[model samples]
Target: MGDTHKDLIFLIPLPGGRVARVPIDVLEHYVDPSARISHGGEAEEEDVTAHSMSVDPRTGASIWHTDWELGQCDYTDENGFPQSAYAWHRHPLGNEYTEIYQK
Candidate 1:
């Protein structure tokens, strides 16, 4: 029997206000994780907000893509009551592709 895996999908924005539903497996095949900027801590996983880079089939230029990260509330409300909590905080990871391209 073949191995079974969960389907992880990401909605990526395109050039003309269009979006594409891409699979995690496809992104992994094209993008190199080490090539991109690092974020978060040891407890944080690259498991969220998938980002990747790939070549445009038509233009033959490299393009960086990303999905939305899950948000959470970690602070207390104005009433001084605990609102909610997040497992971890998200950090800004700049575009490695753009930096390289601009050079």
Candidate 2:
């Protein structure tokens, strides 16, 4: 089956045992800015959100998550070397916000 379209909300538990209510399909934009989990002593920025989690806070379990995927033949270059994932990223050009990674 394809992606389902429905009005839904997810209740995610947060720090201090707080629970966050987030709308389906748009949780990333609504992440709790202050939430953080130990990732090499740094925050996971986009993954460790109150609305969405890459890990299970209780067990420290995690799964791979990436916003983009490579297309079939888009994996390598003419040299047969793996393409850099960073090359696919485009910074937010034009002044919409002072922060470059706002989105």
Candidate 3:
């Protein structure tokens, strides 16, 4: 019964030079509009992509960690199409999370 439209896509690029795109939201109701929703106009939901990497687990060394944020308000390319940004996560922590933007 909501007036908004939302779509989500999960992408995984394999080392074999192949990309897999999966629609996780359709598989499970992890997110619900009826649940605690945001009200602010600029408070639009966004989809996040995370990449994790580490040299050694025990030492937690030879490197550090990092992450990136791409909001719904971002641009794709020459076209005005809205595209998600590439998120880089150094450690395999958190939900590997992403946001669902209201369109």
Q: How accurate is candidate 2 locally (lDDT)?
A: 0.37
Residue 90 of candidate 2: its Cα lDDT? 20
TM-score, per-candidate, Cα-based: 0.31, 0.23, 0.22
Candidate 2: regions farther than 4 A off = 1-4, 28-103
Write one digit per residue (lDDT tens) for candidate 2, span 13-97: 4434467887677876667654333222344554543221245455565532232211111134457665432222121232111
> How much does each candidate deviate from the true structure in C-alpha RMSD?
13.5, 16.8, 14.4
**What C-alpha lDDT do the candidate models reach, one value each?**
0.42, 0.37, 0.35
* lDDT, residue 37, model 1: 29
lDDT of 1 by residue, 1-103 (tens): 2344437777975443468998778887888543432233442363344333333445645543333222342334467665443322222243431111110
Question: What TM-score does model 3 achieve against the real structure?
Answer: 0.22
Q: Which of the predicted structures, 1 or 3, would earn the higher lDDT when compared with the native?
A: 1
By TM-score: ranked, best first:
1, 2, 3
- Any residue pairs clashing in model 2, and if so which? none
Query: What clash count does candidate 1 reach?
Result: 0
The lDDT of model 1 is 0.42
